[model samples]
Target: MESTHHQFYELFEQLGLPSSEQEICDFIDRHPLPGDVKITQAPFWTEQQAALLKELLKQDADWAVVVDHLNVALHH
Candidate 1:
């Protein structure tokens, strides 16, 4: 399956993120399916994706963990 950052950028490009951070926030808030969550089947995801998703789901924390992952992916 594709990694979260790849999925994120794909959605970002699709949604035209340049409009505003609000747009990005709304997009993220909408909670697109992770590669693992098949609509008609059981869950499936790699260890890395699951771990990252766990962190991503932890809102109300000080830092933006999902953005951190995206940054790491971008640098690599």
Candidate 2:
């Protein structure tokens, strides 16, 4: 089966966050995650956002790649 690809900004949009490149950069800068913390467990996320992120990762859905990218970005 062919995989569906999604952009990093689209992940933010789906989470009801600012989707602009600058905004995404700002968000990551503001909410840096500790090395041990998972992105979905970040305090900055709402319940729905966390749930969506968990679901995407659990299912390895189309948004999973972007979600992983965001996770790495936050930890840095």
Candidate 3:
């Protein structure tokens, strides 16, 4: 099976968010994820955005790596 690699910025875009490098950094700085909270449960995400993240993670989809990257960034 062929898998498509996805970029971090593309995940933001898919979530209907600002996808620019600086914008992504700014967003991460603004929304720090608590150690106990899952990225999909972050209050900053809209219902649809959270659903997408959850679905992607659950399926181990192409966007999963980028989503995991975002999750790590928010936890910092």
Record all residue pairs in model 2 with backbone atoms less than 3 Å apart, i.e. clashing: none
Clash number for every model? 0, 0, 0
Error of 1 at 34 (Å): 13
Candidate 2's displacement at residue 43, Å, is 0.5
Candidate 2 TM-score, C-alpha based: 0.95
Q: Can you tell me which runs of candidate 1 are displaced by over 4 Å? A: 1-7, 10-42, 60-76
Q: Using alpha carbons, what is the TM-score of model 1?
A: 0.26
Q: Estimate, for each residue in 17-59, the C-alpha lDDT of model 3 and write its tens digit.
A: 9989999999999999899999999998999999999999999
Cα-based RMSD of candidate 3: 0.7
Superposed by TM-score, candidate 1 places the C-alpha of residue 52 at a distance from the truth, in angstroms, of 0.4
Where in model 2 is the C-alpha error above 4 Å?
none
Would you estimate the TM-scores of all the predictions? 0.26, 0.95, 0.95
| Candidate 3 displacement at residue 16 in angstroms | 0.4
- What's the residue-level lDDT of 8 in candidate 1? 51
